[model samples]
Target: MSQNIFIIVCIIFVGLLIIAEYRAAKRLDSGFLKWVAKPAASLAFVLVALTGGALDTTYGCWILIGLVFCLLGDVFLIPTGARTFLAGMGAFAIGHLAYVGAFLSTGPEISGLFLIGSAGMAGFAILALRWLWPNLAEFKWPVTVYSAIIAIMVATSFLAAPGQSSAPNWVVIAGALGFAISDIAVSRDKFITHQFFNKSWGLPLYFGAQLLLASSV
Candidate 1:
């Protein structure tokens, strides 16, 4: 369909942009391209959700709005400065809340799954601290907290009704883990230590998480 092609095009464009960013070393465009592409991607998600066999088109459109906020948040993160960075994180937190709202639209079948995912998120937090704390040093708490939130949010998706059982659980799982990993690396790179490297890894992992999150819906 046209919408599917649009999504495909957005993905290809983002991938190419990332490659261009990497080759350019310091990023030449000020991330305006990130701005344009994300909304396109978000719109494509809504189109797919509405016309691609969803039961509730209205609900799907609203959920897609949450996705739009996330894309906007990514746009805000472009400056590589502290305020924009934190704002980006806040925007994503809101997006997660929107996702939570969407999941809740399915009712309480997911409560048990949510609890399980919460425990897993906590366990991951403890494990992350034990594993990365010493190496991370200064920014440990921030990264850990961010990852904890994401783990819970991502896992919470499983709480939604299996109406869309066609959704790929692995993509969701990868997205969850990707956010945790990339954010940890980002915190280290920005706040704690310079020992960690890999913009390539960070870019793909974080954006891939978003890409997968959008697709899983």
Candidate 2:
């Protein structure tokens, strides 16, 4: 019961932090809030996972690690620079790998749904790369590699969705899809157009996805 309470509190806290982060980045243009709230929001998910007993199982442990890396990515993205952006991307790439590891650890069955999902994810990756290729500039290769990693992560999530994983199938699929879609917003904001519109949708989707994954623990 206490654990459930803690999870609820953390969820509320994370939601508020995400709202504050959006305001800081878009409306107030406040660096202090952006720096504080973004990482705080990420950390709240980590706490949620811990409170949910994430360290008790192999799948949960990998998810915990992924969340930590995503937290680092959030921190790296708080500052504005090419190097920092690259660093942030690298961290997120690592986080995606950790998620892939978590999903693979589930020993998912190789079913028709899994094959279809994998193919769809692969096609999405191809289309996304084509869309972003022109504006990627010097970061083209890194972004391509990162895109591939996330695609694989999503594909593996599909594999883990057949009641073989610690998380419910719907939760696993929704979290992965949300996370992947949110990245499109991020990519558009960074490489195509620098606008608040991107964050309006992306931040919520990203945080929600993280929260869902945390809850799975």
Candidate 3:
């Protein structure tokens, strides 16, 4: 697609995402909005990536794969149940690993930025896991593993920033950080407290992050 057309499509889908988030914030029960609008919003990122020529390069291809897995994660999360939640988590974990692969495709340098980012992420992971430990119950180990994967994903993005040419460094950095921060909201909603406040901010951050990453393609 032409650049103008791509921008217009992105704007339209962003509107769709806003409507979906509004629906989610207003309702607690699962219904048509959850099953239909939510996934449609999630699918927007994949469309964005494809139209942006995500399949044209190795980094873009891996990012497209990650976006697809994240879409599945969004779908799996629509329903409320332990099995479904676990399924969603697993999908997201895989998505993070795909992101790691995408960064690796850039042949990232182990610069000071990488070391600092890794250390910062490690610290955040320790704090977050400790906070969630009390309520994790049977999900403790799984959550831990997922956290580790996501931390690595973010760190890898930092590592790739100085060398990757597939996308602007700011796009990758902002997308990764936004995604990681949004997950804190998810964790709080799921394990700490149930509130619309979490979804209100988390959903937007998530979709924005995905859109940014997709546009990078």
Model 3 TM-score is: 0.89
Candidate 1 lDDT by residue in tens digits, 1-217: 6546755765675666565555446535535565555455545554554444444544354457667777777667656666687777777777777766665565546456567777877787677667667765444665566566666666766665434563425555565567667766665556554432455577667666665555555
lDDT by residue (1-217, candidate 2, tens digit) is: 3445644665565566556656755567566656666777788788878887789888889999999999999899877699999999999999999999888887777777778888999999999999999999998999999989999998888766423434437787788899999999989989999776787788878988988887776
> 107-212, model 3: which lDDT tens digit per residue?
7667888888899999999999999999999999999999999999998988554233533387887899999999999899889988777877888788889888
Quick one: ranking by lDDT, best first?
A: 2, 3, 1
* Candidate 2: residue pairs that collide: none
Worst-scoring 10-residue span by lDDT in model 3? 159-168
Q: Which prediction has more favorable TM-score, 1 or 3?
A: 3
Count clashes in each candidate, considering only residues at least 3 apart in sequence or on different chains: 0, 0, 0
Cα lDDT, all candidates = 0.60, 0.82, 0.82
TM-score of 2: 0.89
The whole-model C-alpha lDDT of candidate 3 against the native structure comes to 0.82
